[model samples]
Target: MKWRTLENTAKIFPATSGKKDERVFRFACVLKEGIRAELLQEALNKTLEEFPMFLCVLRKGLFWNYLEESKLRPIVREEYRTPCSAIYVRDQKNLLFEVTYYKTRINFETYHALTDGTGALNFLKMLVYQYLMLAYPEYVKGPVSKLGITSSTEEDMVEDGFSKYYGSGEIKEEIPRFKSYQFPYHRREHGRMKLIEGLVSSEKLLQKAREHNTTVTVLLTSVYLCAIAKDMSIRQKKKPVSLMIPVNLRNIFPSDSMRNFFGWIDIGYDFATRSNELEDVIAYTSDFFKRELTLKRIGARMDNLIQFEKNPLIRIVPLELKYIFMQLGAKFISVGENTAVFSNIGKINLPDDCESYLDYFEFYTTTPTMELCMCTFQEHMTLSFTSAFVTNRVEENFFSILKELNLDVRMIVSGDSRAGQEHFPDLSKETATHDFWYRLFTFSCLAVMVISNILNYLLIPEMFWSRYVMGGMASAWIITSVGYRKRRNLLKNAVWQLVLIGIGLYLWDYATGFYGWSLNIGLPCLILSCLAAITAIIIFFRLNSADYMIYMMITCLAGFLPLILNIAGIVQFKALAVICAGISFLTLAALCLFQWPAVKNELIKKFHV
Candidate 1:
C-alpha cells in the first residue's frame, strides 16, 4: 500500500525553440473597472489550495525529481522577484492551468520544452477569465468600460464540476508513442509571418470558415503555410505545406485525468496546384487533414514508444544513465524537428455562470526559434492571438496583412506607454536567465543521477541495509496516504514497505557467495518488484502494462551497473557502494513520489464514467 509522491522521478523535457532551452511569449489585457490584484489573488489562492498539484517545482539533485506539493508551491502569489514581478496562478485558467490572475499586461512565456502554444494560450485565457470573474462578479453578460471587449467564452462562473461531454465514448483512441522513425518531415515553404490574433463574431467566424470550406485549424495552418511559402519564396516545391498538431490524449486514454495528457499529431499536405484563393486554400487544407488524423495512427505511435522503452538494454540502464540514451532517442523520433508546430486547443469550455463576472481571454505562443508559434483560444466569438517571431518586423508584417484582410484587431506591444512597462524589462531579463538555467539544469540533473548511481557501489554493508530501509520508508508515503492523504495515514504503509525493503537489502548484503545475491536475493527483488508493479499498473491504469515495469527494473540494474563497472575499472569511483545506494533511493524512492494525483474530479469522473 506504500506509494511515493508523484513529483520525484518525473522528467520534464525543457521547452526548446531551435537549440535554445528556454523562450517565453506573453500577452496582456486590461480588465473591466473595479478588478484588482488582491481580489483576484485571493480567489486564486482558494482555488489552488484545493488543487495542490499545480504548486510543484522542479526538484534539484542527481536524478530528476519534482518538488513535494508544498506551501511554497506556486499560487496567485506575486513574486516581487527581481525583473518580471507577477502573479502565478493555476488550472481554472489553462490547458495546463484552468486560469490564474496576472497584471493587466502580462507575458505568457514558458519554455517551449514544457508544452506547445495550444496548451499555453488556453492557459492564459483561462487565467484571465478566472481573475476577472473572481474580482468583479457583478459585471455579468456584457462588454465593460473603455476596452469594448465583452464576455466571450466564460467570463462568469465556476466549472460545471466535470466535463459535460463525459461518457460519450466518442473520445477514446490509441496513440503510438516510442516507435522507431516515421518519415522525417521538411518545411514546404520558406517565408514566415508572425501569427496574428483577431476578434471575429462567432457568427462571422463560422460563416468565414464555411465560405472557405475549412475548420479553424485548417484555415490558420494554411495561413501559416502561405506566409512560409512567401518568406522562403518556395517556388516549385511539390505540395509543400505541413504543420505539427498537438493531439489531446484525455479522449484517447480511458482516464478522465485533467493533468498533462496529450501527444503530437502531424498534419501536412502538398498543393494540387499553386493558384488558389484563400477560400480554395481552406477547402483543400480542410479536406486533406480530416482523413489523415485517425485513431489508428495514434496507436501506432504508442507502439513505437513501447518498442523503445521495452528494449532490454534501455530498461536495464539506471536512472543516471537515461540522459545519454534519451538524447539519442529524441533525435530518432523527430519528424523534421524544424517544421513548425501549430497547436489549437480550440475553444475552452468555461463555466456558464462565469459570464456574469469575466472579461474576454487571450492565448499566446512562444519558442526560442521558429518561423512562428500559432495559438488560438475562442471565447464565445473572437479568438485571441499570441504570436512569437524571430524579429519584430515579422510580427508587424503579419498584423499588416490581417488588416488588409479587413479583420479588426487590437495590438498591445510589451513595452508600450501603458505603465505595465514595469513588468516587461524584468520579465525579458528573467526569460534570458531562465534560458541558460533550464538547459544547464537538465544537463546537471543527468550528471547527478549518473554520479549517484556510481556512488552506490562503495557502501558499507550495514549502512546499505539501513539506507534501503530509510529510502523505502520514505517512498511508501503516497501509496498509503492516497486514500487519506495525511502524515498519520502514511505511517502504516510506510512501516510495511520499510520492513520489506530492509529485508530485501539485507538478503543481498550478505548472501555468502558473491553470485548468490544475484541468484537468490537479487532475483527475488527483481521478481517481487515486477509483480508488485505489474499488478498495480493493470489495476490502476486499466490498460496493458506499458513497459513501465521493464524500465523500473532497468533503472535498478543500471544503478548497480556503475558499481560493477567501477570494480572492473570500466568506471572508477571510491564510493561505488554509496552511489549504488543512491540509485536505489532514486529508482524506488523517487519514483514512488511521482505516483500521486494532479486532478480532483478527474478521479471522481473517471470512476463514474
Candidate 2:
C-alpha cells in the first residue's frame, strides 16, 4: 500500500472532528439544465484518473493519521443526505470525499483533512469541465486538456507546501489573545444545522467596496462583525467579536499544490470600546488586514505552527494520546479565542465557452457554532451562513444590513433535519430482526439439550449422549465469537483462528486418547500453514514488508514453540518441528538483515513508551 503523512495543519482536523463539528466543506455548481447521473458518473471516473490523491482513504498509524491508497471507488448518486454531513468515518476504508447531484446542482463534499477550499475548487472545476465535454460534445470539444484550469504537474498536486516554505527563522513575538464573545443562543438537538444562502449582484458588491476604498473581503467582513454584534448583550459587548479567517498560502508562496496550502488569521473588533457603525468598522477592518496580511506576519505564524510537528517528544507520542491533547487545545485555545469562522474563496473562474452551461456556484462549511463563507461567479456573489444555533437571527441581521446598503439580497434557507428525512433508511429495524433470530437459535439449542437429557433419563442411564450435543453448541459459539471479533483485519483474523483451532485440536486429542498426535504433528503443521498464509497475503497484495511485519513476527515466534517442546522431550516427533523452527529462524534473520530499519521503526512506533 502507498501512504503519505498528513500535512502540519491537517493533523488536528481528524482529532477534533465530530458530529457537531464535521470539519467538512461543500462546493456545488448549478447548471442551466437538470443533472444526469450517468454522465456525471463518467465525469467523476475521468476526473479521478488524473487526480489520484483524492481517491485515497484516511488511515491511522501509531504516531499519525495518513492517507493510504485504496481500491474503493466512489459512486455518484442522487443527493439525499444533508449538506456537509460526515464523510470520514474512523477505521473505515471509504473515500474521503463524496459527489452527488440534486436536480440542477452537482454537489462535492470533502473531508477537510484531504484538502482546503482552494484545492477542492480546482478539482470541482475540472470535474465540471469533464462533465460538460461529455454531455455536450458540440459546444465544448476537448483535446484532453483541462478547461479553465492552470496547468500543473501531478507531483505538484500532492506536494506539502508547509514543508517547502518553512525554515529555521527567528520566532516572532506571540500575538495577544483574548476570550471572544459567543452567541448566547440554544443549540439544536441531534446535531441539526441551519444553512442560509444570500445571493446578490457581484458587480454591485464590488462597486460598494470601491466606494469604501477597500476590497470586497474587508467590506463583507465588516458587515459580518456588525451582524454578530447585533446579538450581543450589554455584558457580552465587553469582549471582542473575533472571526477566524483562512488565508490561501499559495498566494504568499510560489506553489501549485492542490493539498491544504492555507493559513488563518483571527480578526476581531472591540464593540464596547470602538464605534459599532459600518464605516467605523470598515476602517478598523481595512487597517487590520493591512497589518496582518504581510509576509512577515504570516510567515511567523506559519513557522510557529510547523514547529510543533518537528518536536522529538511530540513525534514519539502515540496517536491516540496525541489526539487527547489536540482536542484539549482546540477547546480551550482555538474555540475559546474565536466566535466564528469566515472563508472568502474570492471567485469561480471558467473558460468563456464553458460558462454558458453553468448557472452559478455555492460554497459553505460545517461548524459547531457558526461559519460564513463567500464566493462569487460572474454576476452572483453568494454569502452562505452555516449555523448550529436554533435561531437564524445572525443570518437575518447579516443580509438585512446588506439590504440597508441598497443591495438586492436574495435568501435561500435549508435545515439539516428537514431536507432528507424521508430518504433515510430504517437501519434500526433491520438490526432488531437480526438480533431476534440469533437469540431464537440459541434458545432452540438449549431446548434441544433439555429434550435429549429427558430422553436419556427415560431410556439409557449409563450412556451420556446429550453431552455431545452440548459440546457441539459450545464449539459453534467459540467459532462465531472469534470470527466476529477480528472481522476487520483479515491478517490478524487468520493468525487468531490458527492459534485457537490448534489449541482445540490438542484438547480433543487429549480427551479421546493420549496419542500425542496434536503436539507431534497437528500443532507444528498448523504453524507452517499460518506461515504460508502470511506469505500469500504479502504476495497477493504486493504490500510493503513493514506493513505486515507485525503479523510475520507473531507467526515466527509461535513457530518456535513446537520445536522447544520437542527439545524438552515432551513431543516425540522431530522432523516437522525442526523444519518449522528452521524456516522461522531463517525468515527472521532475512528481515533483520535486509529490512531492519523499517521493521525497527514500526516496533518503536508501536511500543513507544
Candidate 3:
C-alpha cells in the first residue's frame, strides 16, 4: 500500500509520546443498553471501509513516520485496561486505534499522532451509528443524514487542509510570544494518568457564560485560572496562570479533512499584576479572545509554521535526526509555556432517533500536567480532567465556582463503585498515598541537610560543606528507592539514581578545591559501573539484548565525553579516559559480534536509515 506522511501538526506527536504524556485521547459513548461484541466488531469492520485513513499502521520512513494501509482487522473485545493507554506503533503493527466495549460504553481510543479529537469523534460516531443501525434496523430505517454516519469520499476525508491553506507569498510577520507561568507541582507519578469527570447542566452553563458576556470556552478558561490562583502558594501568586486552548481549524478554514487541523491560543492572567477576582479573569480572557483568536492572527501563525516546514535545509534532514530534534523541541514547548490545557470539543448533535439510545459522551486527552476536555450531549455537558498530579485542589475550586453559580453538577469517578449520579465530594481530603510519602521524603531531606550542616560546623570546621554533601547522597538513595518501589523499572530508576549520585559527588569533589579526582577517577568509575550493571541485567534476566541497545549506546556515548575533554586539554587524565574508552569499545564489539542481527534491526528501526 502507498504511504502518507503525517500532517504538519501530527508530526510532533510520535516523538512526544511517553509515559507522562501518551499523546492519545479517548471519546467514549454510553449506550442505554449493554454492548454486543459481535455487533461492535462487525460495525468496526464496515466503518473502516468508509474511513480508510484510520485503517492504516504507523511505519518508519527515511524522513518521518508514515501511515500505510493494514491488512489485519481490529478486534472488538471487553475493555480490560484504563483509558488512553500507550499505543506502541511498532508493536501493534496493524492498527493505530482500539475499539473496546465495557457494558454499555463503547470506547474509541486513538493515538493523537494519527488524528485529533475532531477526527476521532467523527469516526466513533460512525462506528456507533453503524452498530445501532445493524442491531435494530428498524430504528435507522429512514434516510441516513447524520454527518459521520454518511459515507465520505477518500479524497475529502484524507485531504491535507494545512497544505491547501499554505500560501507561498504570505508575509512572514513575527508574532508576539508569551512566556506563560508554570504550576509549582511535583513531577508526575510513574504510572497511568488519573481521570476525573463531572456532568453538568448544559443550559445552566450557557446561561452563566451569556451573563458574563463570553463564550463557553472563555468562561471555562477564566474559571480554571481562578481555580489555580486559589490553590497557588503565596510565592507562586507572583506569576501568571496560563491555559492552552486548542482551536479546530476546520471551522475557520475551508476543508473536509478529517485529519489533524487545529491551532492553540494561550490565555493567562498574572495574579501579581492583576486582581484575583473572577470578573477580572473573565474580562481579561474575553479581551484576549477578541485580539488573538481572530482569523488574521490565526492565519498568520499557520502561515509561519507552514513556511518553516517548507524550508530547504529542514526538509532534507534525515528522519532519525529529525526525530531527535523534534523530541527536544516538544519538551521545550510543553515545559516552557502553559499551566494547563482546556480543549472544548463543543456540543455534539446527533439525529433524533440515535439520541435516544445514546446516553452521554466524555472526552479526555493525555497531558503532562492537568487537562480538561469538554463536550455536550442533550442537556448534559461533561468536563473531564486528566492529570498527573494526585492533588485535586484545582478541580475542587473549579467545581465549587460552578456550584456558587447555581449550576447543578453530577460527579462520576472512573473506578469508583458509586457510578451513578452523586454530589461532588470534598476533594481536599481525598489525597493519594503517594502525596503523603512525597511530602515526608522532602521534609526528611530538609531535616538531614540542616542537622548535617550543624554537625559539620561543630566538628569539621575546615570542611563545613562535607556533611551537606553526605546528606545529598543520602537523599539520592531515598529518591531512588521511592522511584523503584513505585515503577518497578530497575533500569530506568537505577540509571537516574546513578546520575544523581555522580552529580553530587562531582560537586563535592570540586568544592574541596580543584582536584583531578572527580574527572580522572570519579567520572570514569561511574561510567564503568553503569556498563557493568546494564550488562548483568541483560544476561541474568535473559532479556532481548535489542531492547537495551539505546541504553548501551548512551553509556558508550557518555564514555566518549571524557576522551573528548582530554583531547581538548581541559582534563589531564589520559589513563582513566583510555580505560573507560577501552571498556566501552569492547562491550560494543561483543554485542555486535554475538547479536549482530538484533543490533542491525534495531538501528534500522530507530534511525530509519
Indicate the residue-level lDDT of 37 in model 3.
Answer: 94
lDDT of 2 by residue, 59-143 (tens): 6677888777777899999875678888987645679999998878899999999999998998898889889989999998774
Minimum summed lDDT over a 10-residue window in model 2 is located at 423-432
TM-score per candidate? 0.52, 0.77, 0.69
lDDT of 3 by residue, 312-419 (tens): 788778876887888888777647578889999998877787788998998987788889899999998999988887677788888899898888878866422112
Give the clash count for model 1: 84
- The regions of model 1 sitting more than 4 angstroms off are 1-19, 23-30, 59-68, 75-102, 105-134, 137-202, 234-239, 251-254, 271-280, 328-338, 371-389, 392-405, 414-609
Question: Which candidate number has the best TM-score?
Answer: 2
Q: What C-alpha lDDT do the candidate models reach, one value each?
A: 0.41, 0.84, 0.77
Which parts of model 3 have CA positions greater than 4 angstroms off? 148-151, 168-171, 174-176, 414-609
Ranking by TM-score: 2, 3, 1
Q: Which structure among the candidates has the greatest lDDT?
A: 2
List, residue by residue over 1-609, the lDDT tens digit for candidate 1. 111122100233421122222233343343445446576565456544333344433222223322222334333433233211122221111212222334543334443323334334444444555555565567533122222112222211111112322232222344322221122223112112133344544445556566666666676666655544444433434435555666664455543232334555554444435544555566666765665455555544544443444466654554446655555555554534434556555554444544444344444443323433333323433333322333333345444554555655554333221124432233323334534654564465556555544555455533444444434433343233332322322222333343445455545455534443443334334434543554465567453212143334344544554455456654434354445545555655544455423122222222221
State the displacement of the C-alpha of residue 67, model 1, in Å, after optimal TM-score superposition: 6.8
